[model samples]
Target: MRKYFHIDLNDRSIETQTLSGEALARAGRHFIAKTLLENDVATVDPLSPDNPLIFSAGPFAGSNFSNGNRLSVGCKSPLTGGIKEANTGGTFGFALGQLELSGLTLYGASDEWVVIRITKEHEITFESAEPYMGLGNFEASRLLHEKYGDKISLALCGPVGEYLGLTSGIAFTDPEQRPVRLAARGGVGAVMGAKKVKAIVVDRHKMPPFTDRKKLMGSIKQYGKLLREQPVIENFGKLGTAMVGDYTNTIGGMPVRNFSSGQIQDPKDGPLQVGGQFIAELNAGRGGETTHACMPGCMIKCSNVYVDEQGEEICSPLEYETIGLMGTNCGLTHPDQIARVNHIANDLGVDSIEVGAMIGVLMEAGVGDFGDEGFIKDVLTEMHKGSEKGRLYAQGTERVGKHFGVKRIPVIKKQALSAYDPRVIEVTGVTMMLTAQGADHTAGNMHSIVCDDKTTEEVTELSMGAQKNSAAADSLGLCVFGRSVTEANSELIVEAINAAYGCELDPSFVLETGLETLKMEHEFNLQAGFVTEDDQLPDFFYNEALAPSHKTARHSAQAVNEVRSAHF
Candidate 1:
């Protein structure tokens, strides 16, 4: 039996419900889709008390399966005004799983500042959180650890979220209790802030039961050994995602200076200064650790620690998306300076990608100058001080672009592009255009989807297939990195799910569940007033040709609609 703790913040009431049979499909992305559709919440205002945010752990969460402990945070996004599900890696999901629980449904708004604490004994407590209000994420984490002991799983927010910044994200502490790993998209934290929650302290000490522990252990060990031998997985452990900078720049897909060009202005030195090799050197000199895991039992440790000139900790897990948008896109070549901005973004509890894009738009509007470290530092300070521009900046890239009237902003459905500019990597651009998540890279990471020969005619199928595959992985609660294993060897996933829940499921059944989840999500978006016209990239992507490659976005609105209408 799996438990669900429904915490209504309005009356400070905690209720427990049990889910079983077909209802508990591992509680990752799929479970969220089911729950959202069941509640018919798509048409409701996202920030209203009626919209519930679900925190669900995957089925293999409390087990030894590699990368098993992912937390799926789903809500009607205040950012996209549609259904949003952001999955993150960290200790929080596994901790929650120890309570024999699949998920927690958070509803109703609190009258004032509140903190929800769940203990090892399953006791839920609500307390005043105003004393800790306005504190940045790192400090708030330190104070929470001091009060709750260092091992407690914490999900917290900073001043920016409390101020309802549209880009605010929910920050979760890693195993070492550092506040960094985040469900960092779609304004999930602003929804929590609107619910009047400052932090959620969960200390679940009991693990979920496995029907056949011996068989489950054997399957996980076999899969783990197989993943260890993969070269791509190995590189992820070594270089992390920051390695994408070198390749994207070489291909002329890296957005430079707010999508004005793809090629770096100083061709000889630009890539060298801002790419992965620079980050590797910085790590070597500062004694920072690379190949760090954000979650327990993750075989692909694609994260790193970043330190300053004095070898003092600045931030951890400085990612490729942050590298591209905050580094090359802003004309910033100093790795440490970018790391500092990444750190500030984390502290402010905002999405670093959105912040970086917003800064580029401001530069385009002549409010700031690109490549000026002092100017960026000053801007960050103003955001911290809650100045008018800072508050405007917190509204995210799309709103800021609208305010500043920047034409060439690289956006899809008002959300800023992650690292990949659609001009060069055209297949991924297709995914960005058609998906309901609104320009999210993970909507279906276009990296893995390819045919024998990638052609314009093949774009729709590749993007649709990638999205379907990704949706399946999300629904299964499996890391997308693990897709090579679970997808290719579907029986392995079936075996694990059967062993976890004592249920019988075949490979096709697993595939269909994923497809169904995507359908539910698309239906929800439709109900939220999203029409066929919203499926294409912004106007500039259609008109502006990127440098070097010189290719504009080629997908016509009709082509995109054709993909959307195929009914994936």
Candidate 2:
């Protein structure tokens, strides 16, 4: 029998249940399906669902592998009126896995403020936390560390979430209790705040070994070997994802100044200067300190703890998304400034991508001139103060556009696009339009598909394939980084599953689950009153002519409309 605990946040209660083999299998599939379904249903509701957040760590989470540490957060995105699931690399996945918990479902509103602490041996406890109000993630982490000592892993939110900002996100503490890792997107932090729960403290003291330990270890060893042998995996570990920043900028794929241009002036002959510069500076100061693993048994320590000029820690894994959105897109030339912006976003609990895009739009509207570091700092300072202008900015791009009457806003389904410029990489635009989760790049980043194609038909087909593959990756709790080398090798994943569960499952089932999840989310959105018209970019993108590369939007309404028909 498999044990599971269902906690009700409203009354601070818990229900324990055990399931047979058949029941466990069914529940696993249902839980995965329902996560996609519930968010879809909530998308069309006028007031939105109260505290509907689903956090699921996969069956392979605790295993020793390069990519085993991934967790999924599903909720109705305030940024996009569709289901959104943002996955992150952090210790929370491994901790949850050790506790043998399949997932956590948070629902309903709470009357009194509290924080829930769960452990392998101790019963769930809802403790009053009135003293910790209006604290940022760092301070919150300090308080939790004081109480729980150094062993506990925490999932926390900050004042931004408390204010119910649309771009709020949940922050996960590193092993050292620094609030650096984040399941940070789609306003999930707000959902936690709505439940009147400030944080989730997971203590896995003396947790028992997972069932089928021998098989699990064997599969983990096999996959770990494969990951080690893979060239891309090796490269990613060494350089991380920002290695692509120079490449994207060179190809005119990097969105700059709110997609006003794709290419920026390269100080070097190649576009490698920006990425190389950041890597050099980071390494020079705190490069070799410790490339820490987000989860306990992870081998791919792609995450890093970056320190600033004073040798004080600033952020972790200063990633491509943050650099792209905050650095290039916002017209900031310096990486340190970008890092500071990233730190501010983390402290505020808002999505950095959305905030970057929001600030870009503000620059476009003369709220602050592009590349004005002083003005940018002032705006962020105001936001921290919760000023009226700050509140408007905190609402994200679509809401800000609506409030300010800016017709040139770049968004699809009410959410701003990420760092990639769709005009240069056309297939990703298709994914952004058709995905049930609005304009999320990860929903189906078709960049690789476009790279592999020689013709338009080939591009379309490969993009569709990549989209399906991404969905499958999400369903299986495997990082897309792992998928880059594996491609659609379902058998390899199935082998891992068989090793973990002592049962045979065709890897193709993962693809089916992905499709099923997508369909369920789509149906829920339709029921929630989201129409075909809602799946579109703003008209300004069509008419505006972006400079530098001098590229204008070429996708017609017919072409954009074809995305829904092709995918759905």
Predicted structure with the largest lDDT when compared to the true one: 1
What C-alpha lDDT, on a 0 to 100 scale, does residue 133 get in candidate 1? 90
Candidate 1 has a TM-score of 0.96
Candidate 2's residue-wise lDDT over 1-568, tens digit each? 3456666776656777654332333222235447556444463432243536677776665556556557777666666656667777666766766676656777666777787887767468888867666787788888888997777778886777776777778888765667777776667777777777788888754333555767667767777777778786666666666666766777677878877887655635643544644564465566433355666666665655667767776776577778787777889766677777778777766778887888888888877887776776676666667788777777888888777777668787777787777666767766676666667787677564344224444444555666677776776667777775445466676666665555667666667656666676677667556877776666666566555545555654455446435656
lDDT of 2: 0.67
Query: Model 1 scores what on Cα lDDT?
Result: 0.80
Q: Report clash pairs, candidate 1.
A: 30-475, 67-297, 98-206
* Cα-based lDDT for every prediction: 0.80, 0.67
Candidate 1: tens digits of C-alpha lDDT, residues 105-174: 8898999998899887788998889768988888899888889886688998677778788888899988
User: Which candidate tops TM-score?
Assistant: 1
> Which regions of candidate 2 fall more than 4 Å away from where they truly are?
19-40, 43-51, 206-208, 267-273, 276-282, 285-292, 448-457, 555-568
Per-residue lDDT of 279 in model 1: 80
